[model samples]
Target: MASPLDRGGLPGHRVSVSPLDTAAAARHVATTEDGQRLSLAEQVAQVPTDPGCYLWKDASGEVIYVGKAKNLRARMKQYVQLTDDREKIPLMMQLVASFDYIVVDNEHEALVLERNLIGQYHPYFNVDYKDDKSYPYIAVTHGDVFPAIKYTREKHKPKTRYYGPYTDARAARETIDTIRKVTPICSATCAEWKRVRRLLDKRPDDAGIIGLICAQKGRPCFDYHVGRGPGVCAGMISPEEYAVNVRRVERFLSGHRSELTRELKEDMSEAAAELDFERAGRIKRRLDVVDGLDDRQQVVFPTSVDIDLIGFYREETIAGACVFAVREGRTVRTCEFIVDKGLDVAEDELVAGFVKRYYDETADIPAEVDVAVDLEDADVIGQWLSAKRGRKCTVHRPQRGEKRHLLETCERNARHALMRYMMRTGYADDRTNQALLQLESALALDGPPMRIECFDISTLHGRFTVASMVVFTDGRPDKSQYRRFKIRTELDEANDFASMSEVLGRRYAPERMADERFGSRPDLLVVDGGKPQLTAAMRQLEQLGLDIPVCGLAKADEEVFVPWDDTPVVLPSGSASLYLMKQVRDESHRFAITFHRELRDRAMTVSVLDEVEGVGPTRKRAIMRHFGSMKRLRAATVDEIAAVKGIPAAVAQAVYDTLRA
Candidate 1:
């Protein structure tokens, strides 16, 4: 018998309702761009009675939200009947022009597909975790003859084992350094290896060359002399010998400490029995390193216990989640995530969604998962995790005992994480409210500028000119509302004023003003320059017939220039008002420069490809699509370049040569 969690067993159908037949019920529905509409009743009637994922799209056909349901028709009825009490639901319904769904085998498949689609589309109404930093990982190349352990942020390569998405980059680097000391693995690209390579280059190539090199008996690197590296570069160790150390490092990192310690002890004993005191001493050192690492881990349970505890601290529409990964009775790792709860979602739903998303990216899965809140579908999530782990797994909420106590501790850490995030982003604090008030008094505004917009222009000479608009709501960045513009006006030289004016005109145009995505007009407008930029912005607003307050922030003197005054208002050095201004200004500048660099680099890549013979626009595009960037293209060999469609071997050679040059 097939388990309920089985996926992709049979093809399911897609259900969509046409809008033409539902004209009588159109009052309850939003219309599409092509005069098409579907009433909530018609939508609910057409949905099939099956488990699946549904996508709610806006009139512009953009997916605004994605959800899963055990019964599609029943779920549709709930939305149509306006039963969900989430504050954003009513607004979402107003914007939802249409919805469609894909039937699946069961709720397990629905859950999997929903998480995938959410990750793919990043629907606005979904709970998306937004963190700018990419955690570092300890990566070991699996296919290399003598594998090397490395610290990397990216994990896209095939046949590579990645151990972590460590929250602390310094800790990841330290782990790699420690592994190098204990494993004696050779880093082929290190300075010591390169020095050895230079010596090999001066000698004639022969079958016995490595043996002859090793016969010299001189240490090729400091690490070799210090016993931190196998003398692979000096040809003192074979690949087979080096692999033993590599496996030891892998076992140590994989949390198989007991087995690794046992194996090390056996090796040490064998070495001593053979009268090899030196090798036995080396093995003893490795055992000490392994034991030292184990000693640092906090013991949370008996040796048989292995579990993961997830705790959350939510405030309004945002939440901070912390994970404590326990293995072999000790807490091995901790990770933190920040979730943007766009709607009023329940804590149980939040926990389930987070577990599914978090486990999807991680390689390790424990036998049990303890969450801060009880889940409605704990069994379903456990089934999914069990399938993922190829073993039985359980998801539960602890009621009492050490697990509950530890869970409370995890929640406290989660609270700290949230507090740190609030402090870092200047969100939801008395200080932030005071900063807004300070700005209001300093700028002599009628009220606090609750919605502040800052504009900045970036360019290299006269090339790839761009403008950015950054929004701050309630004294914190509202990144979703941020906008970027490419300066359409051609200029012989960089013109900050002209760029600023063009961007302002485009942003406040009548058509854009009516669009809901732009939201309400900003309470304050700030340009990233002095009087000239401010005057240019003011002129644009006057032409548009708008009376919003405008100001300029000059970077040179850190002075704030208002349209009503000639002398700049110098905000107090340590004032929150000045700090807020700097934050907004710096963010806008960074956003503009990032966009500008994207365009500039794209142009540079095309121009560089143009230098190669027989490489036309089509071929250049194919090459760019294949490699994604100029750095990757330059790293490609001639044969790899030839693999791109529409390019011949000769042209590939030419392109490769040009890129290298």
Candidate 2:
């Protein structure tokens, strides 16, 4: 007995098609070179003694590495003369056939160009993320009246400021959670906060109403009694006051650890002077969080100065960077980045290259940077960092002192990270390779399912139709290749069949085969359903005159459906092959759910506003700010609405009429 969703029917599926893919396509990255072969030494001889970025091409003349230099000649010399300092140097030099350099106005320009080229080329030797969204940002949705500090991915959105392309998503979230202990900001979506806000604002004096709403919200959200919220939803804190709290969070995350604490202390004293006990206590708690962390920082200097101590280590199989974020004379946090260079690259170049990638991806950069590696073009790197920070920056290898000791500590950390990376990669490879092999044998495919793609559609009662395409490369999430869609179909009824058809059709459409999302066809395509869904996917591939293995993982009894078979192929329960299938299916479901929630939340806020002719975003903000709540504006007399600063009498009357209707 199979449930409807797990069987031949798809009663709860949809096509999520969005016009937003156009914006994503605009950021499409590709290599700039024509794969021209040139002599390495000859090209190096032509390089000027000026600041610039250089690209090293393999024998095939494809860029394997990108590096920047203060003096092009001095930096290029390091590559030609191999050093035992790096194990990869000999290997890289063997492959070096030709190279090119982009002359820039300054070291700053060179650094910027290096980043751009790496993003475009994704050189094998550069520290690059497999997926764009791999780094998570603690995003403040300042675009909304009630901003929330939450985990958000960066894709350059408007009105929202992002912090840290934090290398570790868990660490980023942990930092935010710790911040909430001192200055509580809303973690809810704008619509959710707005609903609670309206209720509390309209009944400002009603303590009972606040209790009822907060209780209904349960333990997970906005507990004013526990002070997990700044009392915003209950109208206990003014919007202006909440903005100040959010600013503190921004400053803390922006690497202003010492400066932010001083401000918090001053603000606490002011609150105490005014006899605002609660406000003073809240500020004190924030001070405690800043002062009380187990930072493991040895007091190197009595006076505080911002610095980032960096070190790198390379093993036969793996290489890594250890970055100690020293703020106000203390090491506040440590970040480690490790990657397997496809081609052998020298350790010195790797350190320089990693530094560029890290600072470019993250918002936090220090005024003074100390490195264990010589970094040949330290002055150029410092100049570029200075420009980025709108202040002076110094990048240098430390002489004997506390700075040298810190670099030693950073190097030790890098060694530990290298060991961990080696262990993890070996274990991960065994599990993933075994799973892929098992999956291949079970499916009887042409080869291992190294790159498997799963598609799942999500919608709420035919609203905000959306779909997710999740990619797993080598049996690990390749988030960079993940694609999202908002489907457009004129259906009087919800149809999983049609939704699957539309999403699959658009994905494999002849024009899309050359597109990055579709150009690299998956080794295996797994749809989230049974016979009908499997057929819908196969039909699309057939229409496109393509032949790729397709299957469906029906939720009912964990049955799998292949095009050639009428009956399902149910893998052994709890088997590794089946677990791999379930993992992909679940991931697609989760990705689709998040997109669906975002769309629904957006509609809850914008649909009503969109209907009001006189109320664009500007006018609407004024109205919300003026009345404090939409409930108030709905009940307001025309004169009260007209009295709002930005609204004319005619506009106010129109707004009043619209709300009344």
* Candidate 1 ranges beyond 4 A from true positions: 1-36, 85-87, 143-147, 155-158, 185-247, 429-661
Which lDDT values do the candidates have, in the order given? Answer: 0.79, 0.72
Scored by lDDT, model 1 comes in at 0.79
Per-prediction TM-score to the true structure, in the order listed: 0.56, 0.48
lDDT of 1 by residue, 17-82 (tens): 333224543433445456565465665676688888777888887889888889988887777778
422, model 1: CA deviation in Å? 1.1
Distance (Å) between predicted and true CA of 587, model 1? 35
User: Deviation in angstroms for 384 in model 2?
Assistant: 1.3
User: How well does model 2 score by local distance difference test?
Assistant: 0.72
- The number of the candidate with the highest lDDT is 1
Task: Candidate 1: give the clashing pairs.
Answer: none
* Positional deviation of residue 426's Cα in model 1 after best superposition, in angstroms: 1.1
